[model samples]
Target: MNFLALLLILKIGLSLALLVRPFMMAPTKALNNVMSLYGDNPLIYRLYSIAILSLCVAYGFGLYEALSGRMPWNVIAFGIVSNAGAALALTALNSHPKLRPFEATFATIAAALVLCALAPNYALMSI
Candidate 1:
C-alpha cells in the first residue's frame, strides 16, 4: 500500500526467483550455463542458496514492519550485506558486460529498501 511495501514485494520476488534459479533454469536453454560449472553437489552452493532465501524472507518481514519507518537491526544487516554483494558483483562482472545491469539493479533496489526502512514514518525503535 506504501513505498516500503512496494520495495518489499520487489525484494521478495527477486530474491525468491534468484534462490530457485539453479534448479528451474538449469537444464533449460535460456538458463545461462555460466553457473552450471559449479554443479549441484557443492555443499557451499546449497548453503549459499539457503542463506539467500533466508535473507529474502527477512526482507519481506522487515519491509512489512517498515510501514512504521523503523528499520530493524536484522534488516539493516541484510541491506549492508546486499549492498556489499552488489558492489562485489559490479566489480566482478567487469569482464562480462551482460551482467552490468544485474549488479546495478541489485545495488539500487537494496539501497532504496534500506532508505525506505530507515524513513521516519516506517521505523521501529525497539529492534
Candidate 2:
C-alpha cells in the first residue's frame, strides 16, 4: 500500500525468485548458461543462493516489524549498505556480461531499499 510496503514486496519477490532459480533451472539449459558465464562451481553457486535467501529472510522479518510499527531500521540499513557494497564489488570484479545485469538489479533494489528506509513517511526507528 505504501512505499515501504511496496519495496518489501518487491524485495521478497526478487529474493524468492533468486532462491528458487538454482533448483528450478539446475540440470537444465539455464543452469548450463549460468555455468558457462560464472564457471561450474555448483557448490559456490548454491552457497551464494543460500546467503541471498538468508538476507532476504532477514529483510522479511524487518518488514514484519515495520508493519507492526516496530521497524528495526538499523538492521535494514545494514542490509541495504551490504547489498550496495556487494553490487559495487561485483561490478568491479566481474567483467562478464551476464553478471552485469545481476549486479545492476542488485544495485537498483538496494537503492530503492535505502530510499524507502530513509523516507519520513516510513517513520522507522533504529534498533
Candidate 3:
C-alpha cells in the first residue's frame, strides 16, 4: 500500500508538473516541439498547452475522488482514455512520424504515467 501510495504521489507530481509547465512553471522547448507535431503557431501551442493542463487538472480531481472512494470509477474511465491516446501517439512513432522525438518521448511518458497510475486497482472497479 505504501509503495502504491508513493507511486500515486509521484504520478500526481509529474502530471501537475508537465501539465502546468507551459503555463506557470518552466518555459519548455516542448512548445516548439508540440507545434512541429500538430500545431502551426504560438496560439496553437497555447491551446494545446491548455488542453494538457486541463487533463492534468482533471486527473488530479479524479485522484482526489479515488482517494475519497466517492467516484474513482469516473476517474478511471478518463485515465483509460488518456492511456489510449498516449498509446496511439506512441504507436505512431513507427509510422507517420511527424512528431519530434521530444514530443513522442513526452507522449510515451505521459501514457506510461496514466497506465501506472490507473493500472493496479483502477481497471477492475466499476461504477
Candidate 4:
C-alpha cells in the first residue's frame, strides 16, 4: 500500500496495543514498570487508551480518504501535531534512565509518524 496508508495502519495498531497494554501487562512485571512511572492506577492508562483508540477510528476514515487520492489535510495536521507532541513529551521522560527504552521507542515511532504525515506535502512541493 501507499506510505500514508501504511503509517495510518501502523499507528492504529500501536494505539490498539496501547488500549490493551494495561490489561495485558497486569499479570506481568511490565505492569510494575509502568506503575512506577505513572502510578499504582491502571485506570488512567486505560482511559488514555480509550481516547487514543477513538482517534484511531477517526484516522481510519482519514486513511480511506487518502487512498481515494484526496488527502485529508485536517487529519494530516492532527497527526503531525499529536505525534510531534507525543515525541516531544516523551523526550522529557528520557531523563529517567529506567524509562528511556520505553520512552525512546514510542518517541521514535511518534517522530516517524510526524515525518510520514509531512512527507506527502514535501513531495508535492518538489513536483
Which pairs clash in the backbone of model 3?
none
lDDT of 1 by residue, 1-127 (tens): 5666566677778767765556333443333344434343555555666777777777777776665555555776767678668768666745466556667777887677566556635533323
Candidate 3 at residue 1, lDDT?
A: 26
Q: How many clashes in each candidate?
A: 9, 0, 0, 0
Best-fitting candidate, measured by TM-score?
2
**TM-score result, candidate 3:** 0.54
Relative to the true structure, candidate 4 reaches a TM of 0.69
C-alpha RMSD (angstroms) for model 4: 4.0
Question: Highest lDDT among the candidates is held by which one?
Answer: 2
The residue-level lDDT of candidate 3 at 114 comes to 63
Candidate 4 pairs with clashing backbones: none
Model 3 lDDT tens row, 91-111? 664443454443565555456
Winner on lDDT (3 vs 4): 4
Total clashing pairs in model 3: 0
**All candidates' lDDT scores?**
0.62, 0.68, 0.53, 0.64
**Model 2 lDDT per residue over 8-83, tens place:** 6677787678645664346544665754544554666667677777777777787787776665676568768877
lDDT of 2 at 5: 53
Alpha-carbon deviation at 60 in model 3, angstroms: 2.0
- Each model's TM-score? 0.66, 0.74, 0.54, 0.69
Report the CA-based lDDT of candidate 1 relative to the real structure: 0.62
